[model samples]
Target: MARTRQPEVSNDVTRLITQIRAMIGKGEELPPERLLADQLKVKRHRLRLALETMRDAAELPRPIIRRNDSPVLKSDVVVQGTNALEVIELRIVLEPAIARLAAVRASPVQIAKILEAATTPQGVTRTIGDIAFHKLLADSSGNQLAASLYAFLRRVGSDHRLHVPTASAITSERIQQRDQEHRAIAEAIAARSPDAAEQAMRQHLRRVQREIADRLNPLETA
Candidate 1:
């Protein structure tokens, strides 16, 4: 029997997989397909074949295509199924560490961005500012994996549907307090005080948890 030769695409797919694995190991997000194909010196069609191979092998998370043909992560569905409290509890565990790392690792430019994000602009929803502030901290953590994970967490946490039950609890006073907490965390990171950053982040999350719990308990009683 003669040995069979694999198609050229098989080799290209293997190369693509190897490169993607390297990027993952380095805690970097996969680049856009066109840019990645260019970088790998592979044709777009070959890149698509490589992606299909990975997907078939269950090597990649199944992507849900939106109306715009954007791929949303499978984990997003799981997050959407979970309640807000669960999301906040996870944030309590993850964000303090992120803030600590940001304090230690954030560049001056990142610090400035963090500070800017900390303040909610007039006529803008505080929720948007809050998300931006925390996201900046995550991005500043100098760990791309952590940053990516936080982005997922943020998306779920910010989903209005998840927080509808506690929406009434978000008063002007509470928003002010939350903004103050954001500022505190930003200041700690700006000062490069890891301990302070960690503590501030923990305190802020705990306060949010408490408020949500207070609201939920009343609803349950009713």
Candidate 2:
């Protein structure tokens, strides 16, 4: 008997997820099926199949509510740039401590995973991949306190993306900077330098905070 090829279901799901992430990066509010079908250039049925696959993979959550109405512009929504600044500020207070704990608690496998995620080509996905990498780092840290804080930080990052216009301003250079900072923390952790990791992480976050503050309140220093 001839060998049969498996359906590329996983590839389809990954494609869908990438498209959705790209749309989110551009701050576009996409319609569900039509957007998927149009972007993926697949039939509605295939699009639905891809969506289901993604949902199963936990790349997307099942929709809680469906609407037949037209999209409404939310004028009351806060500007996204400001929201991103708030998220960065919150992380400045939270992630350094997580880094410290991760240094003390992470297993070798978990540490390797964290480093791999931070240094991977997929890390170019910017906000989405970066957030996922940080979540994995927190989980690897094996500290409940750090895990909870990481979850909170992830939520804040998500909310910031939704509300902040310039959130996708993450560039290759910026990603490189973030990757280096994360690598420094990870290396310190691997070396059992908890205090050094914490300090490096804190310093990186402080620089981020300062950059955000400069953009948000440029007149403050004058």
Candidate 3:
């Protein structure tokens, strides 16, 4: 199958991603960006790009933050049902455009419903209803076929826990960021600007993908 059009990283960066995948899989912390860059024989900029494009490594500078209370999310069930990479690939193809369409076509009721689904009420388990946001986006897009397909994807995601976000990614800072992103999406939809809505949605999805990588790698500052 053809590869997805993700970050325009060089082959060297791609190789570095694979190498880091191994290190992370083995429960190793990623080296500093400078050291990792040197080890990969790539420029620091290229290394950063690879890390950002690959996910969690971009946020390594923040801190690894081990929590006895909150376990990092890793969906072996979802991974068993289907490839993690494939789920991301599928989302990259379907979601941004669904957001775009929702912006242009969503009724006021649909918009309210979307915002409702995206926000969890106080005391609700954060992990539940993870698919509601994207699923609502598809349904609001005024495309029945797309909505049906997204429903199937939603089932796959919910059944396998693929839609759940990592525990750390829901930190106060990250929550603020998500709220801003969601606000941007809602504003764009209200304004009926497909372009902005699409962009905002894509950014949100990309961030989630990166968070997944971070959970897998759990790279700490070195």
Candidate 4:
């Protein structure tokens, strides 16, 4: 029997997707059609087609919008408010289970990647890097359903960050605190203690949720 050849992607489309992936991987916001066309050295139509294909293939996630269907603007106060609420809801539903599975199934290499992502000293905290870590943790959990759910939750988190201010108020002390929490989670996983890992992760997420809520509702903070 003859082997069937795979469909080849056009050079232009491939190049455009590469550029788009690079921008997304670095957590950079993409510009609109005209700017993307210029950056990718392609026609506007080609760029649009490439983007559409990538989105359809799930390489690019869908945009989150407001009630009127306007794309959420990153600097808009209303978008930030919406994001603050959404992130809290997502974390409460996702992290505990992921942590439990990670404790049972994460291999040494996967655990190391999670620890490195959590501990890295980058000038700007990269949301992509953090997300990659979480995804890896989910994969390591050896549960397909948990992994899929984590992926969805991560997209929501990414959209929220894109439309909202991140922890601009993150101080050195706060970073250290986060690092410690991550370490505790990692250690519990390494020890194969599912209960401990889940508890640690839940505690960390609750702390993060409270901080974000406090920022969103200063009256709560008071």
Candidate 5:
């Protein structure tokens, strides 16, 4: 009698499950299926099977399914009364900690994403790249709850156009300066220097706050 081997798809799913466990912290929610599959370079169906197996084994949390009759909360409803300055204030307090954690916890792939997001591409809005950089740090922190909270903050900032600066403020010199600051933060994380990463993030946010304050009241800065 010949030995029976497990199916190739089953082996792939098992391998993905192991990779995912290594990639994320315990209790961290996996990224969306499509994104996770893309990131792992595995087929979506295989990822789904892996997720299902994990869920059955109590390794992953149960999905949150909403009833059709439940009221869906709108973004505006959830993020009321917040302005740009307030958002920056919250980010100043929150992001340095995220940077520190990213220094210690970020996987190699996450560090690559953080580095890639550090500078704005030609013709893209600087604010968008900045948001992506910060959010990548948050996600790389290995804390899913922290990542979710930071995502909410970013959504609030974007929905209200709170972070976009006026054309007059978007000078080439300022852009270059911001790029340097972003790289400093990213490099600190890559080097696994938690204190340096935290300090760099704090300095960057403080600079942004100063810019926003100057914009809102030019006289005070002058």
Candidate 6:
């Protein structure tokens, strides 16, 4: 006669994912299950459910995986030579999936951070804000494997667009358009619409890839 309640494992999973992200970012290994459960003030059973979910997502032998130590994969497929194009290719593959997860799993605080980053001012803050906004999406996704791979991709040989002079690449109109695009993606995620979020992210990344291509080959546009 009474409605059955879902096991409280989702909250536990979110908490564990949050802690694991922080720990891995600092190069700190996760403590044993018993210790973590005690520290998190959760029962072992709930903690175990969360731990198992995370373990499956990780699929790694070790708890804390450092970025530098990750194995390099040799792929004969897709664009691989140019750093900028390669980074764009990976974004096309991963960002939409991450956004879809973020739509369902992101916490209130995480959403707030994403919003804040999206609205942050340009100049020095622009670069940092852009980085934070994207990283926060991955963090919100609650998928450590995706998050870690995104992190590694950001650090590896890429366009390093942040360091490159923004004078040419970042025009005033471009900045305005980017703000609108980011807000659209953020809105989709905050509204918890996975399909919308995925589409929004995909559209944004495609625009970026196109811009880079056009820049690299002005003759193509001509």
Local distance difference test, each candidate: 0.77, 0.65, 0.66, 0.69, 0.77, 0.71
Q: What is the lDDT of residue 51 in candidate 1?
A: 80
Off by over 4 Å in 6: 1-81, 122-125, 157-169
Pairs in clash, predicted candidate 2: 80-163, 80-164, 80-165, 81-164, 81-165
Q: Candidate 4's residue-wise lDDT over 1-222, tens digit each?
A: 999885667887888788886675454557877887887777888887778877566444444333584544433453455565576677767787888988877767667656665663465474454555566567677676667667655555556453445445657787778778877887888888999989998998888787767767676657
lDDT of 5 by residue, 10-95 (tens): 77788988998655332234678888889999888788888887655544434545457554555576567668888889989899
**Predicted candidate 1 versus true structure: per-residue lDDT over 1-222, tens digit per residue:** 998875555665788888875553333446788998898888898888888776554444334444675546655587657987898899999999999999998877678767876777665566666776777688678777787789888777767768646545457887788889999999999999999999999999999888778777886746
Candidate with best TM-score: 5
Candidate 4 residue spans exceeding 4 A from truth: 1-83, 123-126, 160-168
- Candidate 3 global CA lDDT score: 0.66
User: Considering lDDT, which of the candidate structures 1 and 2 is the better prediction for this target?
Assistant: 1
User: Could you tell me which residue pairs clash in candidate 5?
Assistant: none
Residue 10 C-alpha lDDT in model 4: 88
- Residue 15, candidate 2: Cα error in Å is 19
TM-score, cand. 2: 0.56
- Tens digits of per-residue lDDT, candidate 3, 42-77, equal 889887776776543221222234547553444444
Candidate 6 accuracy as lDDT: 0.71
Tell me how candidate 4 scores on lDDT: 0.69
**TM-score of predicted model 6?**
0.62
Collision pairs in model 3:
none
- Name the runs in model 5 displaced over 4 angstroms: 1-74, 161-169
TM-score head-to-head 2 vs 6, winner: 6
Model 2, span 1-222: residue lDDT tens: 998875666676567667765653343435778866876687788678766765554434355453655434232243333476666777877787788887887776667656666653552466665666666556655565556556655554566353434434667787788888878877888887889988988888887777766666657854
